[model samples]
Target: MWVNLGVILLQFLSGSIMYSYIIARILKVDLSKIRDGNPGASNLWRAVGWKYGILALFLDYLKGALPLAIFVSLGIVKDNFVISLAALSGVLGHAFSPILRFKGGKAVAVSFGAWSVLTKWEAPMLLGTIFTIFTIIKPKGTTVQEDAFRVILGYLFLLPYIIYKSFHGDFHLLIFYDGNFAVILYKHYKDLWGYLRGQS
Candidate 1:
């Protein structure tokens, strides 16, 4: 039990690396001074171009995927829990990275990576569906409002899965679906408000 607790704590700490922010600082860019004040891939692309943006995205994904990979390699936890904890930690780190004063990205890629590893079939299928939708109806402008709407709509679409998994007694499923989904929704609380106001 203590070992499990320690692993969880380590996972959270590792997840909070804020790869994008760190890279921005290393490149001598003050992300807070930029438009939208977000240190994510899209903003990085605008500020630095595709190369740095892609690098930051990859590192952010790695920060989540690698730790779980380590957990499995070390036989630190059972398969189910390790995958669950890893996905949670990775996304949590990306969303509320302590290193960046709790300012971070939308937890999309990191969550996708961890989910893909943890639940090979379901995770990919779900994420692919989201990708397809976004591809078809890509948002025009690059604003926090647009990004937030994308996240809120995406999670609303997936809410049914969370309900189904809960009834099926698949708590590990919840670990992947509910915990991460809820985090994304809560993170975009302001966006939700803006969206509702516009509709009214």
Candidate 2:
């Protein structure tokens, strides 16, 4: 139990590093004053440039991937509950990083990395395909918020597919995916609400 706790704490710390914020600081760009006021790679791209943005994205992905990979490789927490907890800690930390005063990225990239490890890339590939199709269909000049909403909608569409695939077994995986979807929706509640209200 203590080992599980330590693993979770370590994963959270890794996620809380706020790679975008660090990159923005080094580039002398205040992410808070940038697009959507998000201290994330997307905002960093808008604030500074794509180079820094890509770097931040990679770092965020690593934060999620590395710790979980290490824990699994070390056989620290073999049970599904503890393993899921470790994965969730990274995402929660990224979404609500302590270094950024408990405000952080949307966890899109970080979640991708973590889920890739957990699901052996099946989930990410499916989601990425959906996201790509949506991106292609999105009207030009769409606002960032709108694009994000479209992505979430895509994920919503994925739920049925996930359920269909797991009909034979793996009920725990359904719960895991649902929990992730819930976290994402909750994190983007403000944006989603504003979009619904036609308030930019």
Candidate 3:
């Protein structure tokens, strides 16, 4: 029990680091005052530059990937439930970072990182392919709102594929994906609401 608790705590702390916010601070920019007022890689790109944004994205991805890698590699906890819980804790921490006063990013990138580790890279790679295809086919001048919608759609598409290709019979794994998707939608509630209301 103590080991499990420790792993959860460690994963959560790792995810709560807020890499974009840290990068914004280093660039002498306040992310809260920027586009969409989001302290995420996308807003960081608009606030500072793409280079910094890319760096932030990579760091945030590492926040999710490294901890799980360490825990699994070191044989700390091996149960699927514990692994899923620990990974989701990272996503939760990224979404509600205590270090950032409980406000944080939308968890897309961190989700990619955690799912990559959890699925041994298969899930993220497949989803990335889907996102890339969407990006390519999307009309020019696609607004951020449109892109956001596409991302959500892409994930929705991923759910069925994951179920079919990977977890066809594993109800628990399917539930884990559903929970992660729920967390993401909850975090993007405002954006999604605006899109639904024809404001986005």
Best by lDDT: 3
In model 2, the Cα lDDT at residue 105 comes to 82
Reference-based lDDT, each prediction: 0.71, 0.79, 0.81
Q: Candidate 3: what lDDT?
A: 0.81
Which structure is stronger by TM-score: 1 or 3?
Answer: 3
Model 2 misplaced regions, further than 4 Å: 139-141, 164-169, 198-200
Candidate 1 local accuracy as lDDT? 0.71
Model 3, TM vs. native:
0.91
Task: Give me the displacement of residue 166 in model 1, in angstroms.
Answer: 5.1
* Ranked candidates, highest TM-score first: 3, 2, 1
- Per-model TM-score versus the true fold: 0.82, 0.89, 0.91
Q: List candidate 3 stretches off by more than 4 Å.
A: 139-141, 165-170
Which one wins on TM-score?
3
